[model samples]
Target chain A: MYRYDEFDHAFVQTRVAQFREQVEARLAGQLTEEEFRPLRLMNGLYLQLHAYMLRIAIPYGTLSARQMRQLAFITDRFDRGSAHFTTRQNLQLNWPKLIETPDILAALAEVEMHGIQTSGNCIRNVTSDQYAGVAADEIEDPRPTGELIRQWSTDHPEFSFLPRKFKIAVTGAAMDRAAVAAHDIGIRVVRNDAGEVGYRIYVGGGLGRTPMLARLVREFLPKDDLIAYLEAIMRVYNLFGRRDNKYKARVKILMHEAGTETVKRMVEEEFARLPRAAINVDPAELARIEAYFAPPAYEALGDEPALLAAARQADAGFDAFARANVVAHKQPGYAIVNISLKPIGGAPGDATSAQMRAVADLSERYGFGEIRVTHAQNLVLPDVRQRDLPALYRELLAAGLGDANAGLITDIIACPGMDYCSLATARSIPIAKAIAQRFANPARQQLIGELGIKISGCINACGHHHLGGIGILGLEKGGEESYQITLGGDPGNDAAIGKLLGPGLAGDDVPDAIERIVDLYLAGREAGETFVAAYRRLGHDHFKGALNADRH
Target chain B: MPIVTERGFGPDGWATVADETAVADGGDVIVSWKRFVAEAATLTGRAGRIGVAVGPDFDVDLHVAGLDGVALVAIAFAKFADGRGFSIARRLRDRGFAGTIRAVGPLIAEQAPMAFACGIDEIAIPDDLAARQPESRWLRAVELRAAVSYQRGYRTGASVFDQRSTGGAA
Candidate 1:
């Protein structure tokens, strides 16, 4: 986790005071609703359909145990008893009042957190692989860069009021767990042939009314010119990006409508005009950020061959959890553990304050006092040693988060649809819970491996449904909530948008539609091939035909 | 006493004059419109001392881009919540609309901070607005918490970013 430096601390303090004054003005009726809307949004407060939702950024999805406890306190004090963890790896409190937001911000400031730039046409929270520092295949940790961008994009004057909300993600892992390809700006840290580190920059990728895989703007941007290159891209977008139609206003639309070649030329021209670097980023500063993320200490222990063998033989539950939730780590005797926030028959990604505190305690006890929230809405104890897995699992089971379904079909990514959001046409959480419960069989789930089913409440694509291998969009037809399924979508190194599968299904018929799709994949796929690969080979028309078979 | 400047457009450029007969004098004050309505012979040109007042919702590029002979462009808030005026001011700076660009209407004393952030050099507060203890121009205490002014948008990243200046003058 990147701890706040003095500069970060001072900046947050001043912002708290500044927003406090804005609240005062709004309360006194001096500031009209139109006047106060942008300001409120900038601070991560939104007047949603039901009540005000205050979104707090868990920057890059990293949080300390203390910070987790503080979040619990915020929900308990200023809002309802819990908070909703978003697909963006941020958290939202759905019931905080306008008057209480400043006080809530003041409390967050005490914990070195504030909601500045969390919303409203600014560079949003920078996300990355939740297991970046501990992932086995990662080239290097990506948090340092995530933090760097976090600081630079905060309170930016010129780029504040952009075409729309902008999102950036970075990753060091070769597998791209951050979904780098789907962000407005995605950077992958790579080592050059000279053994020097640089970045692979992709721009204009986003999911909304329009879904796009960010085009590669720079194959290798030097470590020194990250800021300049970013500035260059933003400059081009700001100058030439569309602002006439709100729907066609994102940089992705600009890249698409203006043609990538022209946008690239504009970016190149702007990059040439930038001033030279003076950020004073030395090896020492890198080391300082790295120190905060240093690998957790481990014992030089023999292989856990005996325990693993015994567990495989004695307990099918242990084998299922091992087969489902655990991912391989680079270090011997260590495993990256995912504490599932989505239990079978539970709403995906809804972590209570107590659950948050419990996860924090478990992290400190068996793993490090570090926690991470994945884009798939799972909390990861990234550096847990192999020996500590059992104890951690026990604690997690007690906390109701030990579902042991990390990548399985049951581990669904879903948004708070009509239940919470005013924009949603259909309910998402109930559908997710229903689907997860239906696919609760461990053997059956393992049979359908590496599958991602993302459910969004609407077309806004907040659930990254457009990026899912099988995206389910909830819609309202004649006032009844229905589910629309799309196929061939993916969010990985080879990212692509999903294709819709005809008309939406009745809410009662959603699980059957999903099963029908999975059954099609199962019946016609080659051995060891994932659902997405099989879909790409066979195409969405086949899956649609399979899902809508009963109609014709 | 407060003045409600109800600006409208004619073949002549931007003007607050609702009565066509009253605007004939042009008075000691210059004239301008609330929006850019295309008319071959509308309003005064940039060459004259005529000042244009842009409504909070008007596109800045329309006014800033055609400033070849425009003397001064004044932006109106209509109401304080209108952020379009701030952006209009920035566009003026970017396009090199060096002539005076002021913030008018129910602009509050609090928005004085954002006014400076968007390159608003001057503010025209409503006459009815309760004057702050010492008033807010020239002699007020400079209250900046950050190293730079109006740095609260996308440029919030720790690294340096670019601002488009193509709309402004050379």
Candidate 2:
């Protein structure tokens, strides 16, 4: 985990002061609600249906145990004893009063955190692979790159008020766990044939009312020219992206309207004109940022300790947990433990204050004093030694964090829909809950094998419904809540948006429809094929009848 | 309307002329982009300095060659949330426009630091907005923002990276 330097501390503290004044001005009626909306949104404060939601950025999904404890404290003190982790790997408190938001920000600043750029039409919190440095397939750690972008985009003078909100995701691993294809800008840290590290840049990808996969604008951008190239892309978008229609204001629309070739030429021209030497980061600064992400000290130990194997054999629950939640690590003796937040029949990503504190303690006790928030709305302990898995599992079970469903159907991603969001036209959490209950049996889930069901209450696609293996979108049709199903979407290397299946089904019939689809997949899939892989081979035609079955 | 520069409020130095209005011979005057383009050669040696007021959609690259003797480029923000003016100002500076760049519209006080940092010399706000948010708020915004910035190569003070390289406090 990266520690905040003196400069970082001062920067966050000053931002707190700045937002404090803005809040005071709003309360005093010196600024109207319309004028204060963007300011508060820049600080990650949103006025939801019931209250103000304060979203705190967990930069690159990395958090120290101390920071987790502070988040727990904030949850207990200001919010209603819980918080929802978002699809972007950030945390949101749904009940913070507007007057108390400045205090919340000040508390976050104490822990090397702030809500800056988490929302509003600016470059948002830069996300990366949650298993950044610890993954086995990584070429280089992407956190340093993520951090550099974070610093560069924070209160950026030239791009603070973009035409629309911008998101950037980076991945250093071949697996692409960050969903880089769904971001406004995606950077893949790759090594060229000559073994020099560089970036493969993708632009114009986003998911809202319109879903788009990014196009490869730069086949290979030199490692040193990262900031300058990004500046060029942003400048072109800021100047040319449509502002007349808010729905079509993303960089993707710009790329679509202007043609990628013209956009690429414009970016190249701007890059050529920019003072590269002045804007490009110094090599020393890059080295300094990289130093923070160097791998932690490890002890020489063998893989799959005897005790863990014996514990797995003795306890069926432990065996199931090890099979689902434990992931391979680069270091032989270590494993990545994904603590599932999606318990059956529970909200997808809500964690109680106690659960947060428990995870915080477990991080310090079992591994390094660090934790990670996954884009799938889960928590990760990235450095847990294989020897400590048994004890960690037992403690996690006691805290009710021992759900053995990492990529299973029960591990659904859902947005805070009509239940909490003013933008939602239908309820999403209940749909997620109902689907999870339908597949609650562990044996059944294991048989299904790695299916992602994402639900969104509206077209905003906050839950990333478009990227799920089985996407369920809630819409209001004929004055009734209806759910639409889509299949074959992926968030990985072969990223593709899911195609709509058929007519919408009533909310009560959603779970049964999903079960029919799963049944069809089970009947059609070949040996050892995942849902997405099977969908690709079987094609959309094979599953077209799942929702339209005469089950009356 | 009041013009806010880095130094608090400044006096307006030029008169803005509509597109159909005829230019007078004596004092400094600002004209629309159409008027400037149609009469670029005549405006170059006029008795007064000439400035151009461009809309948000104004393409700087298409008109850069004709702005030789222009004393100022005033970028308009039709709405405060519409941020095309900031990039346009940067484009002008990047294209080697060695003249004053001003933003004119219903901009709030908090956007002053960003406007200044993006190469805009000053901002001209509507009288209503100026009345609500006085010059003191704008000055305070600029002062607070001057304390620290992480971005490099802007018109602001030393960036955090620059300070780090020189071993100075950020």
Candidate 3:
């Protein structure tokens, strides 16, 4: 993790003081709610359905054990006993009072954390692959770039009040773990023919009422011009983006109305005007940022550890967990373990304060003192040794984090629905819980295999329903909660938006509707075929027929 | 009527020329962009300075050439949340507009720092908001924190980034 320098510390301190003053002014009635609304939003305080929600950014999805423990403390002190991890790799404390928000922010600042730019119309929390530096297939570690962008975008004077909220994601690996294609600006670091690393820039991809894949703006942008190029894009959007309608204000709408070529031309013209020599990051500063993410010390070891093999052979539960949750690490003896927050019949990403402390303790003891929050709303212990798998599994089971459902059908991604969100039309957590319960059998989940079921409370698509292989959208129809299912969406390198399956089903019937689709996929799948692959091979028509069979 | 500048509350220097009203008596007057374009030749030949108030939809590039001798430019923020004026002000500054640039509307004191940083010389706040927030809040917006900005030139010239890129002290 990149430790805060003197500048970073001073910057956050000043921000905390500024927000405290603003809150005081609001309480004194000097600033109206209308005036203080945007002010609060920029600091990540949202007036949700019930209480104020504070969303804190874990930069590049990386968190230290100390930071994790700090979040646990915040959860125990300010919020209800638990905090919700979001799809943007952030944590949201749902029950804080408006008055206590300043104290919460102050506490976070103590641990080198702040909720800056996690919400409102600004360049939001920059996200990258959760397994960024540890992934074996990575071309380069994406954290340095993520950190650089984080610094450049924070408190940016000109680009702060954009037409709407903007999100940027980066990925260095060949497989897109960050879901780069679904972001407003997706950057992939690629090596040129001469072995020079630069970025392949994609712009305008987003999911909402309108889901569009990002188009390739610049095939290759030199690494030095990253900030300048991003400025050019933002300037074009801020100047030309439509602000008449709130729904039509995202950059995707601008790229849609004005053709991609026209948008590119405007951005290029703006880029030509910017002083690139001044705008690009210095090579020395880049190196300084990259040094923070360098690999940890590793002991030379042979292949698989004998203890891990014996443990796997002895305990079925341990073996299932090892098979489902553990992934190969860049180091030979180390492994990346994903701690599932989605237990059957529980909210997708809600973790209690005790569970958080347990995870923090485990990260400190068995792995490096680092934790990562995945965009899929799970926690990652990225440096666990293979030999410690059984003991870790026992501890995790005691903490109730031992669900062997990582990447399986039972591991669902869901957003806070009408139960908590003001904009939601229907509840999403209940449906996700019901589906997980229906598919609770491990054998059934393994047989179904690698199916991503994402649910959103509304068309806002915060749960990334547009990228799920089995997508469910909850909406209101004639004052009743209705669910709509979509098929074949994938957030990988070959990203595609899911297509609609049929009409909306009632909330009670959503689980059965999902089961029907899953059963159809299982029946038609060939050998070694994932749900997405089978969906592609058999087309949406077959799934559409299966979904509509009992409804009509 | 209090106007906010970087140096705190300052006196309003130029008078505004409303489209429907008669011309102001003696001091320099800023007119709308429409009036500026239609009466450019006559206004340019005047003895004192001429200024223009541009709406949110004003295209600075198309009319920048017409603003040759204009001493002041005012961008309108019809609503506080509608931030098109900030972009326009920055664009004018980027194009080397050296004259006074003022933000005219009901924006609150919290946005004073943002507007000033985007190259606006002063902010013309509505009476209601000005009375509500006062000048202290706006002055606090400009308090320097002393941390080097990572971004390149937008409002201020030559930040630490520019210095580092030019082989200055790292």
Candidate 4:
């Protein structure tokens, strides 16, 4: 929600110009491919399996209607009329020409957006809860802090080339919707017993080949020392993190190798050496950033349960959608509507240009002209009124964006896998489609309840398979696609890495394998227990037997 | 082997002299930190000012206290992408080392702004790169509006917040 100030505008413009020159240099053979690779990556241009992919950063997953419209325009003109929303709360244009990337970046800058730091070994786009300012349980919005960090890390001289890529996620609510625990650095906004607000910092958490939850490095860091503290952590990691092996270069590995206590001591020593006041942003600037996320205008309407009930009774389809997709908002009479990108038999996070424009229009007309991108690759109209729900639903249904299966079995989180990514060992999209088709019924989904089935093409875990309640990791075994299952993993307040269940199965048999696991959950769940809770009660042995049931 | 500064191309002010070999020429010669430590007394009476060149692993703080007699400090990049030398330059500047800081590497013109911003007085690039990139590109790169960088003490760039505080608008 923070608009670009003059400095931000100038910064982006200068970067665009800089990249344009770099691209020209590459084309003219003035710079070799090796020299240009990192430069291109820093601007979010990746030479994927088939074509170049340009990832555009959506700062903290927040966007205005105008910005969405601009994205739709970019999709229509530059790409093949479709865009993929990534698990990191950003969008990727999968089929852009290498020559036209500068133009694409320039267009994004016009809408106060760009692909800066979306890739490469520098600090990535900072992420936060999609429901940041609107969530009922939020203590404070994390977007301001996220934006502040974004500014601090962009083109940072000391950290431009790190040992490896770094990720940071912030969460304002007690519920960790931003997947903070699985990031390089996680900041949970908290208040002390005396009511003074601060941060609880976590370091070295990541989900790659080796997934590890971040350790709490600082129990309570004063808000003023945020930048200085992060500088200390980065400096220590840059100086000592392993460069011998690419796989072992992450800060998490350093924490694992040297012990968290040693890393913490080093960071504390570095932090003590720096002048905190000189390094940190003025508190007034943070306040200025916070003001941009203040609640929009709302009428004095009371609770809308009765109105919503009446509308639901009139239309069963509307009722199912309202029941599943609508979440409680902090403001009265306003509801948070999640527009599912994962429809039955469709690729997990792909959206057409038309669907994007429709969502933009809906955001402007029904909501407060704002839209949010979720980590689960869904769109959210964060401030829709209860009275306008039916009308918005009709518009959404017509555009084929009316999936009533949010947080249900049909709403799968999947990476692009073998289809688009060169790193993928197996295809994840087809498996996601098969499972969604298997559980397509609304009643069946509602009965199954809050199940997150996340699929990643490879161990890089781009789809966040490590955090799903039902995580499916796709791999290759002797030239054939093999699917592996994990259970009880969560990305919330009590974050835990999922337990691996038995051996890999053929790609064709994955749907049935997931079905068998679901059947076990259905048979064993206690009253009011979610899939994760059911799995915790039953354990991996309970599901391992179910995995081989069909073979028997 | 051309060295460039903001002022322009100039005669090589400092020469790299071997540690054990004694030179009658003044302090214009640059020696390794190890050599500077081992041969300080003998090198102190030279006519030209003495400079010290450090590798990427050299601790700037370890030598900061003894910088009164040193006129210049040169840090090597070894590889263009390794940015540790920039941090060293900044640390030296922050610790009040008021001398000419040179960055030795195969860095191109694009990295000139970042090098200067981190407090490097000049970039002593390899002779081949100097021919390929040329001095005009370096001058153009250094004159970029990078002074509007976002970080506070990383550079003397006017921060967005500072601009706001001074009543500038987007």
Candidate 2 segments whose C-alpha is farther than 4 A from its true place: A550-552
Model 3 ranges off by over 4 Å: A305-307, A549-552, B20-26, B144-148, B157-170
Shift in Å, residue B153, candidate 1: 14
lDDT digits (tens) for residues A1-552 of candidate 2: 677788888888988898889888888777888889889999999989998899999989999999999999999999989999999989999999988999999999999999999999999999999899999999999999999999999999889889899999999998999999999999999999999999999999999889999999998999899999999999999999999899999999999989999999999999999888889988799889899888888888789768887998999888889989999999999999999999998999999999999999999888878899999999999999898898899999999999999999999999999999999989999999999999999988888989999999999999899999999899898788888899989999999999999988888999888988999999999999999999999999999888776332
Chain B TM-score, all predictions listed: 0.59, 0.96, 0.86, 0.89
- Over B1-170, each residue of candidate 2 has an lDDT whose tens digit, in order, gives 78999888878888999888888887999998888888888877779889999999988889898888899999999988988899898888888898999999988878899999889998998888777777888998899889888888788988988899889966
Positional deviation of residue A222's Cα in model 2 after best superposition, in angstroms: 1.1
A159 Cα displacement, candidate 4 (Å): 1.3
Colliding residue pairs in candidate 4? A6-B170, B1-B127, B26-B48, B27-B48, B27-B49
* Candidate 3 structure quality by residue, lDDT tens digits, A200-265: 999999999999999999988989889989988998898889888978998889999999999999
How close to the true structure is residue A356 of candidate 4, measured as C-alpha lDDT? 96
Interface RMSD of each: 8.9, 1.0, 2.7, 1.8
Best by TM-score: 2
lDDT string for model 1 (B69-96, tens) is 4555677766553345665666566556
Better candidate by DockQ, 3 or 4: 3
- Tens-digit per-residue lDDT, A1-552, candidate 4: 798887888888888888898898888876778778888999999989999999999989999999999999999999999999999989999999988989999999999999989998889999999999999999999999999999889888778777889999999997899989899999999999889899999999999899999999999999999999999899888777877787898899999999999999989987987777778888888998999888888888777888889999999999999988999999888899999999999999999999999999999998889999999999999999889999999999999999999889889999999999989999999999999999998999999999999999999999899999999999988888888888989999889899888788888888898888899999999998999998888877888876775441
lDDT of every model, 2 decimals: 0.74, 0.91, 0.88, 0.88
For A298-354, candidate 1 gives per-residue lDDT tens digits of: 667655767776765776766777777888877788787887778888888888888
Two-chain DockQ for model 4: 0.52
